[model samples]
Target: MMYKAFFNALTGAALLALAGAAAADDLVLEDAWLRAVPPVSPTMAGYFTLRNDGDQAVELIGAKTDIAGMAMLHDTETTDDGQARMVHLSGITLEPGDEATFAPGGKHLMLMKVDTIPEAGESVEICLTFRDREDLCGDFPVRREAP
Candidate 1:
């Protein structure tokens, strides 16, 4: 009887520890996800709304995705010649209350030279390199929809 009680207590303690670990690593991602594209599409994009809840400023430098070998921060702009082009972003700085958005036809994750087109309900991982901090891996699932 004593051994049974000890095992029950041990299980409860383990469950509590696991819950705490998950809570500690949780990040608040608002409107976070990937953009879906048609099959045989060579390139795609991703959009999100990011809010920095941490104390310090964060720089969004670069990203990596498995759908494509490279996931880069890109911005679209119209040139003097009336042409649109994408430029690689060095980084985006966010103040404590500031927010950054990745939207279609604007600032977004450029999935150039895609290797495999993700299914409509699959998930992709992005590794974002931050300035003066460790890289963050954010998971975004795929969903097909029009802009």
Candidate 2:
């Protein structure tokens, strides 16, 4: 009888842990892709759609990738002269059901000091650091156009 009770408790605890883990991760990254740049290019741009599916708000602090010396968030802005320029973004916050789209002429991931630009038909992994949970990673396919 004691062994049976212990087994039940253990099973219950394991289930609870699994539920907690699922609840802890609330951010989903989709449509992740890297802009295919020239082989001699030292910088590249990565774009993706980030969605918050959980009830709570998620704050994205930064991004990192082994393929680049540094990865930073950026956005394109038009000046009074109608010229476009890239601005650095410190972070992004998304509420439940909110989706942030990183695309051309808009928010993007600027990967600088790349040792070797990944060719088209290849993929790279980029991890996003969040303030409320563990880092979330997604595979970004190298391409000339959005897919």
Each prediction's whole-model lDDT (CA): 0.76, 0.91
TM-scores of all candidate predictions against the true structure: 0.71, 0.88
Model 1 misplaced stretches (Cα beyond 4 Å): 1-27, 78-83
TM-score of 2: 0.88
> What is candidate 2's lDDT per residue for 32-117, written digit by digit as tens?
99999899999999999999989988888889999999999999998889999988988899999999999988999999999988
Report lDDT (Cα) of residue 129, candidate 2: 84
The per-residue C-alpha lDDT of model 2 at residue 30 equals 89
For residues 27-120, write the lDDT of model 1, one tens digit per residue. Answer: 2455657778887888878877776766567788887776686778999987889899988998999876667888777888877889788887
* Candidate 2 lDDT score at position 111: 94
Candidate 2, clashing residue pairs? none
Q: For residue 28, what is the lDDT in candidate 2? A: 80
Model 2 error, position 145 (Å): 1.9
